[model samples]
Structures are given as structure tokens and as C-alpha cells.
Target: MLKVTAIAAALLLSGPALAQHAHGAQKGPNGGPMEDVAGVHAELVVSGQTVAVNVFDEAGKPVDTKGYTGSVMVVSGGDRKTLQLTASGNALTGQAPGPVQSGAAITVVVKTAAGKSGQAKFSAP
Candidate 1:
């Protein structure tokens, strides 16, 4: 009984670490929420009609955007829009054709030059 209780306590204590690894509960370097997708880190930031996604390596250093491609999907108030993202400087950026609804939920999927893909989710403030 004591061994079982100990095992349960250990699992409970490790739950957050497991969850974070699976769901990326880390904050981004670009002042946005970040997620871990397949060991890469992605950050999503939304401003008005513009959406930016930044990718980082496991060590939190910004990854080169060269040859990287991605897409963004904005969801708000039951409406959804998809935008193509291009590498700009060190980040992937795109603009919505129409004004982005405030408080929209943004999801970004990025593929690196080596073909590794990662995604991040954020909500516009």
C-alpha cells in the first residue's frame, strides 16, 4: 500500500512536467504564448490584421527563417480565415485580407528547411 501511494505521489508531481512537454506552456521571447511542437518552439503574435510567428530552437534561440514556410489560421466570433506566412527577417508574417476581429484565436504552423514542423496557438488581446 505504501509503495502504491508513493508511486501515485510521484506521478502526480511529474504531471505538470509531462503536460508542459506535450503542450508547450512556455511564454515566448516575442512577448507571446509559446508552445513546444515536436521539440521545436513556436511563438504567435497578432496585431490587428498582421500575424507573426517566430520559431526557436530547443535552446530558445531564434531560428533562421530561411527556407521556412508556414500558415496561420485566425478564428474569431465563429468566423475563420487562413493566411499564408512568408519568411520576413527572422519571423514568419502574414496579413489578413480583412480587418482581423479582435480577440481572435490564432494558430500558426511552421515547417523548417529540414522539414520539421511545429505549431503555436495564441489569442489576440
Candidate 2:
């Protein structure tokens, strides 16, 4: 009984350390693993006048957005516009509607085939 109690205590103490190390394997904000927006893995990228978003599954696989739909709200030129997003293959890309200067805040919401919704927030580069 004493040996079992000691083993249980040791296991409890080591559980947190193991979990912390496991979480370390996940990617950080700067384009490593997909950023978790709300409860989904989403990626945000700004290039020229377009903002590209890549949504992935829970297993870190790119999700096909053939019938998926999404929208983006970006603060550009000191104003915000709700832009419609269209999914191409595994990505959802859209124009900012108006000219977006650098360093603008953008928020995106996507609904996948499984009726699961996810959001991702980003700033223009």
C-alpha cells in the first residue's frame, strides 16, 4: 500500500511536466503551427491588397473548402468593411474591398463543411 501511494504521488507530480513538454511541440504565432482562433486552427497572411487565409483540420491537415464560406472584417483606411471570402482549394482568399494600408487589424470567420465555425484574427503586414 505504501509503495502504491508513492507511485501515485510520483505520477501526479510528473503529469504537469509531461503536459507542458507536449504543448511545446505545438507551433507559435509566427507561422509555425496554425494559430488557434477561437477553437480552430487558422492561418492569416496579407499580401498586397489581398488577405489569404488557410484553415486546417484538428489533425493539422489542410481542409478542402469546396463548399465552405467565410467572411472577413478588416479595419482599413480607418474604416471597416465586411468582405466576402471565396475558397479556392485548401485556402480562402479575398480582396480587402478597399485599399488596406500596412498594419491593419483584420478578423475572419469561417464555416466548414461539417458546420464547424472558426475565427482567426490578424494584422496586415
Candidate 3:
């Protein structure tokens, strides 16, 4: 019983470390942060008034987002905005109603053409 209890505790402690090794964070080609979402990599890129999410496969190659849908929820201070994204080229692009706050955290939700869906948050750095 003691051996079994010890083994269980070890497994619980190592579970997250194993998962992190399997899907480590990556840097996307667009110079943005990449995060795992629904077995794919979602890169968040912001430029001027445009917000984009570039999708990539596990191999780090660009994935065609022809039918992928995405949205971004940004919260800064007391303001919150949810922007709808449109599939275009290799990314989902949206226009922010105003400038995104530097301290704001953004969360992206994506559904691929193959119907895989996931959401992840990108904290301000």
C-alpha cells in the first residue's frame, strides 16, 4: 500500500512535466508567441489596428486556415472587447475597435477546418 501511494504521488507530480515536454511553447515565423490549441499551434500577431492568428501544425509548418474561425477576447483595466476574426490567407484577421492595451491579456478561440476547437490565453509580457 505504501509503494502504491508513493507511485501515485510521483505520477501526479510528473504528469505536467511530461505534457510540457511533449508540447513545448514555440516562436512563430511572424515574431509572435505560439501556443498549443486543439493539437495545433496558434500564433497571435498584432499590427496597428489588425489582429491576426496564424495556425501551424505540430511540425511547425503553416496550416491553411481557409475555413478556420477565431475570436479574441481582450481585457485591459475595466474595458473588454470581443473581436470576431475572419479566415484569410494563412491567418484569421480582425480589426480592433481601439488600440489594444499594453497590459491587457488576450484569449483566442479557434476552430479549424477539420473541426478541431480549442482556446488559450496569452498574457501580457
Candidate 4:
């Protein structure tokens, strides 16, 4: 009974980690790849000519839209538009200068507190 209890506790402790590892890179709330950095959760979403991002705190609460900057490079009509993003609420939203057609590819570069930078890629549907 003692050995069984110890094994069960160990399995319980390792279960979450195993699940995370199995999922590898999982999608965030907005259906984009999410990477956890330090205490922040960053996600990227691409739709039409707009690429939106939402940042959340460690406790899954949305963070303020301040002190965070991002740039998006989206390919549309054989051209690329590099737009600077503006933060609103917990999201960073931006519009490409030109019309972004379907099946476009987007790359986002984000900088947060302490000048930490991260990148995410997305394909429009």
C-alpha cells in the first residue's frame, strides 16, 4: 500500500509535464501557437490583413496593453508589409498596408518587458 501510494503520487506529479511535452507546441486562446516565457504567455493570430496577439499573465489573466511592442511582416499579393502593432486591452493588433489575400504567411516579432524578444509564425486561412 505504501509503495502504491508513492507511485501514484509520482505519476500525478509527472502527468502534467508529460502532457505538455506530448502536446509540444500548443495553440493559445486565439488559436495560435503559444510559448510560455518566464511568467508571460504569448500567442499569435493571423486573420486577413490583421495579425492579433494576446499576452497573459502566469495566472492566465490578461495583462495590460503597455510596455509591449511588436512588428508584423505579412506577405500579400507577392508583397510584404511590415507594420508596427498597437496594443489595446490585452492584445496587440495591426493592419497590413495592403490587402492581405487568403493563404498568406505571417511572421511576428514581439518585444516585451526587459527587452525580451520572441517570434511566431502563422499562415492565414
**TM-score of candidate 2 against the unseen true structure:** 0.66
Model-by-model lDDT, in order? 0.79, 0.71, 0.83, 0.73
- The sequence of per-residue lDDT tens digits that candidate 1 reaches over residues 4-114 is 999999999999877765444456777777777545677777776788877777778988789889898889888888899999866889999887776788877888888
Q: Write the per-residue lDDT of candidate 4 for residues 64-99, one digit (tens) a residue.
A: 868888887887667877889998889889987655
Where does candidate 2 stray beyond 4 Å?
A: 1-33, 37-39
For each of the candidates, give the backbone clash count. 0, 0, 0, 0
The TM-scores, one per candidate, come to 0.79, 0.66, 0.84, 0.65
Scored by lDDT, the top model is 3
Task: Compose the digit string of candidate 2's lDDT tens values, residues 32-89.
Answer: 3345644456777666677767766667687678877888898866688888889988
Q: Please state every model's RMSD to the true fold in angstroms.
A: 2.6, 6.0, 2.4, 5.9
Residue clash pairs of candidate 1: none
Question: Model 4: which residue pairs collide?
Answer: none
Task: Tally clashes: model 4.
Answer: 0
lDDT of 1: 0.79
Give the candidates in order of lDDT, highest first: 3, 1, 4, 2
